[model samples]
Target: MMTERSIREAKAGDKAFILWDSQIKGLGAKIFPGGEKSFVLSYRVNGAKRLSTIARVSELSLKAARERAGQELVRIRSGETDPLERRREAREAPTVNDLWDRFLTEYAPERITLGRMTTGTLKDYRNQAHRYLLPVLGRMKVRDVRRTDIERMARIMAHVPVQRNRTLAFASRLFTVAEHWSLRANYTNPCRGVVRAREEPRDRILSDSELAALGKTLTSLADRYPVPVNVIRFASVTGFRIMEAAGIQWSNINFERGCVTLPQTKVGRQVRALPPAALELLKSMPRINDCDFVFTTTGKVSVAYKHLDEVFKMVCQKARIENVRMHDLRRTVATTAAGQGVGLTVLRDLLGHKTVQMAVRYARQADSAVAAAVEQTGGNIASAMGVKPKAKIVHIRKRRHG
Candidate 1:
């Protein structure tokens, strides 16, 4: 047996040596010339000998060290595991930071090239990882991370429910990729079972009056910021996403076909039918020399996303529109189309959505339109039936005596 007194009183020699425990086979206390001490376990498996450090003397008492060594010895004898090899593998495991780097350099770009992921989504993932995931979990081994770790991150970001939910989604995606890459075990994703914060979907849409005001503001500012103003108009008329509108080239337009063909979008390739108003808007845009884009500030590239957003914000402020985003313009287009009796399938195509479910919300607006039409029909029928209207009773107050 290895006693605490023996371990404490053991003298350092000129060379490091282990004092084997008499009671527990293969368990020993290693004493180094530098006066350091640790408990080590030596064992053989399949005719091969290996040594694993159980713990430092300062970390475990003699009884604790004996129990650990006995457990490891039993596992080795049963041919179930090798303690040395397991420790070695753990030491070589990839950390979350490594997984993140691989995700960015391998998984994300590959998915982007395959059209399964969009650049905008990639930008958001990068932003969320840097702002939340990497700071806390980066140092942890990929396989060692638990659900509690992810839940802690979510709790830390609970104040911003939208951001917290997005971060959790991003972390979930990273771990899924890690499993695909064999860096983590399948079905062991730490993000699993972690509760995500509830997020409210944005449903803001610009009304007709607000749209008119916005158009007026754009016209007033067009002379000062032609490209951004035109870009906004294009997005509004086509119901295109902000990035989709900003990335459009002149070559994408077909005046004869009256459509624009996008080789890549959030949902992949799409051909959107352009109304005459949209075509006329495109026709009026002055093309810069040697510029391939429909909207450009330097003639070398399309208008930057940030600049377009800032210009839109300024235009909205001048138009006196409240609580409206540029994306609301896209919603407005969908709502207008739905109210005009456009079916769900056509709305899906118009919005370049992959599924008809994405266009289903606009069905409610169409239903409201139907209800108004029915109310009008009912009024006409009532008049035809000669239904008498209720007489109004006016209340009068008599003068008070002085």
Candidate 2:
């Protein structure tokens, strides 16, 4: 039993001794050898027993201490709150790294992307964190992150505008994932207001002359470096994105159907229609060492990124082409197809674009082919309507669209 008078006269021992109160099951006075005394509350919360120090005996009378203990015990019995968890959280808020770790290990793999992210998305996220985000803001508490931090990161990597924007996007997502994980106290996504640099869409299309020169160069390289030439020619003719070209396996090619079924694309699985020229090109490629991939330099493995880039650069130099990228060849095909009066929907499907809006850019290039198509469409419409040859609609005029 512990009273105000008895607590004062209590002698300190070699170690701490807990003096339990007879009236209260959980109320006690902890007397230490150092002459310190404190009130404690013992109770079970949600099936777990808890022994929590309420206050120093000097701060409150024994009566008050007992009442406080009673209140805490009552609250725990009624299932109101758990102070232990709240205390733990306040003491140990997760850092950005902690949240990212869970994202890599648990969340990313379990998440249902429905075919948006690449197979390498997890690896890419880790690489992004290691290369950029982690170095600048890894140690900061997730709850304390602000929009200014993301914007500051953008300015830091302004030299690499693309990577800067990408980092901002990825960091903003950290908060989104953290909210569900309860990693941070704050719910606001910090990347909302970070201004991204204006980036010019790389829509560079190869001209006919440039294409002819490239074809000649590729033909010359065909004997010496056959694989690189075939890869370039296949991509140029089929309008496949660089990876879509590089990652193609013989299994993906359906000779009977005259199309390649890509199991994993940027958006999802897609089937690209191959023209007669492209089919003939695929037919001409030689198989190597039982490797499934159609575009491998080594019989056992795919061509290295550096090796592919080096050879492509050499081919471009031989063609006397300046600043033309591998992806530009794809744009050239889209533009040429559009100019030849290929409909927007057809073009979208052909390029594996997610929406027709993405294909609208090609509409701006109204070349002679499109102009000729407009004349043909108008004349056909006039004939279908039973209009005379001299009708006012027979003359083809410039319109907003083909």
Candidate 3:
């Protein structure tokens, strides 16, 4: 039997021992030789005995300790696993930080090597993880993360909607992979129902006058920065991504076939047709000795993407063109081709798009082609009506109005 007076008068002996409570089967007060006291529960599970410290005796009254021990015993009898063991497992569980390391080193690289992801996309994932995801969720146990945690992260990054959406996507992928890795349970992804931020698709393209201005600027810069200038020119004519243009090796080019084959790209392997103008431009390039790249800052490596972008910015400034990006050059090529009566299917192949829908955006920008078709149709109609197609307009001064 245990009472508050007995618990208080209990003295530490030469050895530590526990005084069992008469009312609670497994509840006891453990007295240590150092005079320290704690409430403990002694129980058995599957024939093996176990003792778990509930709390310090000084931390709880007799009534409170009995209530806690009784609840734990009831939970055990009702088929719950050992609470102490569950806590131990939780303490050793993998965290978001561990998942992040595996994702970056194992998952991302494997996908990249298999051509399922691009290096650029991997870079973006790294940025999103370090800048947003890790800061909030790194120390949390993978299995314990909830939808509220993910939504809170999204709210924290609400200012940059696009980046916030990207981070959310990254986190979603992380949780999904964690499930596969057994770091978390199945179907327990926290980002499942989270809403992504809205994003407006960019449709900016360089007009004919803008292209001419850009061309003039490139001509002026060609003497000093020939590699970047030619790289930009290649992008404009062939609609290659800037990195694709920069990474072109001489071995990838087939002048006889008039094409360049890229072994790997954002979408995978692609072969782009090289027009006569593009082929001529390639011939005029000065090849460095022992260099395989078509454009190079040094003989060993190709011109970097950063260098190309910086030069493009300078050229745009010199040309006085605003709101034009390097990627818009690729769009300009697609639009120009569309204006020349190129069909959607052909445009898809020209732009190396997997589907015609991706090329349809450029079709809407073919205003010149539309105008030309309308003019030709009207001229044929007039000719069929016995009216001269080229009637000159003679404007006479309007009679003075009284």
Candidate 4:
């Protein structure tokens, strides 16, 4: 019912009115310079107000906008109003990487170590996002992302179950940042409904023969790179993370107390008691005049990032071990402690695990001792049952073939 003449006459004050454009049929231009464009129809939606534009003016004609508005109004009158909710839903969604950056800037710097763990986590997020999420939704507005896209990415990661699950978990936490930063208004995470891949089992315990070979290889490497060799050896004995071991300062050790104080770890600050073997190893290392670190690469408490990878790779190759990693040394320490009948609570404190489940992993690794008992019994079930075990053997095996 709105015509160009009536529209002009109806514009009494600063209020906006629609003018029909002859270039396009059913096209009504909003005369207001800064206001939402909506279709002018015969009746209002729910008799409340005129239905707004179905799409942007750049994309939809006035005719198309009018058609969409009419359809929406028909639904509105039926008490089925979901278009606004749908628009809100799309705008509330955001990707995991979006929230991760917020967490990194707001929380991580103040609370966590800036060494390998933090850097490694950021690196992992970048790699995973680039590999999967970025490809699909990088250019999409964070608030406009859809749950279907997230679910599809999860399905694609099924080929790598462990990494997939980890990636999803990371996404879940990253998206959780929206609640804090107000990047998105919604409280729900998009990954909340997505199915995660199954956790893959890894029985990565090293056997006795493997340990002997590794010891020999480490001894040989001592001639070439004594510092890193000692570092690896110390890590194996103490169960400290490589970065923590590398960052160990003289101030952290107490020869008299027979314990090392770690002011901070991956989870938080903790104290670890040095066993006799580890204590002796610390004593054997040469002390420097001004250096504070127990292991110094360039006269500092922290090791140089570049040299660590080379040293670790060379030692693994020499030991004929494939896939043996620096973190496994922490596992070795936990396994050894568990074999000594250390309780899960004590082990959790020693390793600075925030959760008991992490300590349980070490217990599971120590469970290989059952196999050792079976071997000693010569496969005799009754012999295994009656005899008291003489000694706990935690064998660390090296792979013979690289």
Candidate 5:
């Protein structure tokens, strides 16, 4: 009599037709009907034998079948299991969206410690992530995301360069946080290695003709909106952001000293001296007893963001300028001063940049005045020689040349 154990082992490599049927041990392997290369294993699970595929002895070697059987035996002993069930559980786990929410709550507040972000900027980050990234990749496991996924996302976003670049940057930052926080085993920034779309430069400055048109538009806006006009004028002169100009208070200004002190900026607290034009504008506006803000919408300390949006857009349209943002007006201030021969270090301090490098961008826009100053004095020695400038040259030669 063939032993059951021997019969099971024989099923591994034997091509001969064999079959077994029993209740407890259940039905053993059998040649699949109408096929020689396929076999069925009728095995017991939870007191009932279920049939599962075990490839033909001719196709899958005896060693392979035994090895697979051993692995399946481990699963069969684990109470209840199915390949599809295992896969489904993996699919339902928390994903990139869950982590992004946690990260924004935990990381941003601490890292962005200088102060709160502007309401507009916060909304922008939220909308970009939600609208672009989360819908596609949010359900995928953060660990499962590979460089290829990032590259593909970037390629798809090639049409909208700036926003696309930002979305990729946000994804990169998210992975960085995951690595830093130990949520991931490896620190893989999917966005790190991939090439991104070239970010088009935005260094918009109003030309003289554009400024003339803008001035005309401002005249009309000033007639309709006094507080917004004051804010706009303040922005043009002082290089303060719209919110910063709106938030300015009487206590922050020292008119006698000709200075405006910002307790908080996008970067941090910064101090800027009031220019004569800004001073005159401030002087011309009637001081309101109801509110302390130098510029207010409705006797309140804050200016409505919407208050200036349309007016600024109207000015841009009237001027027929393209891609000119509000912050570009601030650039105009730095550009103006740089053209007036202001030193980079002085402009850095005037603009209240934390570092000199931030001010260096405007350093390039420095006009003829800087070059003129350089040409007016050939060298330091020219100033030293009051009557006649001297030309001096020194030369060096290597030993081989000599």
Candidate 6:
């Protein structure tokens, strides 16, 4: 008898009352003055009358709520059953939120995923859950959730496809943790068949002119924004992710070996060798006597995230570079290093990529070098076949200078 509007309007007075379903005998929705509505089934336990809540209004649709109430009524009428205790025991089943707590406390710390879970990963997870999962699936019992729920989450489109894919990935991992926790009613993960948004690999790299401009801008900002400039220069050569560079400590730097070691990294924690240029830049940076961090104003751990972002933005604006993020420096380093004939293994280690395939993905800005190699091969082939090499034809487009 509860329509959406009626349920919304339903309020309790000074006294409590159940608005029993007209069609169903004992099935009713209990309303409290506090505005909580729940589907409940009234049945007799032994000789005593007992009422057990089926589910919350938000958790189940009206039809599904009635159906659950009906099921509870039928179960009680059937010969030897304690419906109250059964539902009471069923109350112990964790909701998605509860399982999420357990996931953070138990599953994540053990590094159960494909790789090590960093603090940054946990922070991302916490933020993703805060923004996405808990808001959608908080009320649903973890066991009761079907594939459709996960599909619903995946369907939430973002302006960028990466955000949607990341939400899906976070959901998938939650389901995996739920499965490992053995909390799901169905053994299969809801995330398995759900189509996630495709993510394009970011290919932002600074050109020679842009790099020169950036260097000059950083040099100018050295007095005002000393920490970020040095860190930015360090990352340009070392390919350090913003967080990796942010987390750099004086103790991690091995000047003798010309390297910086990250005790904990996104992938496997490893040492990254610095070239003479990066080493010289590191040496040039003035160290604070009491501070342990390579980048800090308070001499605590590192510069505040917002401070780093603001300084970087200011530097970019000063450099006259449009649409350049801090991460592009890492990509620029990788592409430049690869073009300079740096080996894949060295790139993999230097960039802290878990695999060579990931390293290879970063080493993909060698079109000119590759074209030159192909030209040499073609010339050698033509000479062996006694064919004369054709004269090169070049086309140049004139730029409009302001």
| Tens-digit lDDT track of model 1 for 12-43 | 99999999999899999999999999999988
lDDT of each: 0.88, 0.81, 0.89, 0.68, 0.71, 0.79
lDDT of 2 by residue, 220-328 (tens): 9888888777888888998888778877889889999899998878668888899999899889888998998887888876665566677789999998999998888
Kindly report which residue stretches of model 1 are placed more than 4 angstroms away from their true locations once superposed: 44-49, 77-84, 366-402
- Positional deviation of 84 in candidate 3, in angstroms? 4.0
Q: Per-residue lDDT for 71-184 in model 5, tens only?
A: 665677776574334456567645788778886798766655646554445556788788888877887887778888877777777889888878887788778888887666
What are the runs in model 2 whose C-alpha is more than 4 Å off? Answer: 1-87, 90-92, 111-114, 120-124, 185-187, 366-402
lDDT of 1: 0.88
1 against 3, candidate with superior TM-score: 1
Model 4, span 68-150: residue lDDT tens: 76576567667774466556766765554555555667665654554324554666677776787667666565655567878
Ranking by lDDT: 3, 1, 2, 6, 5, 4
Error of 6 at 290 (Å): 2.6
Candidate 5 Cα misplacement greater than 4 A, ranges: 1-93, 113-121, 249-251, 283-293, 298-301, 304-307, 319-323, 368-402
How well does each candidate superpose onto the true structure, as a TM-score? Answer: 0.87, 0.69, 0.80, 0.68, 0.66, 0.72
| Shift of residue 193 alpha carbon in model 1, Å | 2.0
Worst lDDT 10-window in candidate 1: 393-402
Clashes of each: 1, 0, 0, 5, 0, 0
* Over 4 Å off, model 3: 2-19, 29-39, 44-49, 55-81, 367-402
Which regions of candidate 4 fall more than 4 Å away from where they truly are? 1-102, 113-136, 286-289, 304-306, 380-402
**Span of 10 residues, lowest total lDDT, candidate 5:** 20-29
User: Residue pairs in steric clash, candidate 3?
Assistant: none
Please give the ranking of all candidate structures by TM-score, highest first, separated by commas.
1, 3, 6, 2, 4, 5
lDDT score, residue 45, model 2?
69
Count backbone clashes in candidate 2. 0
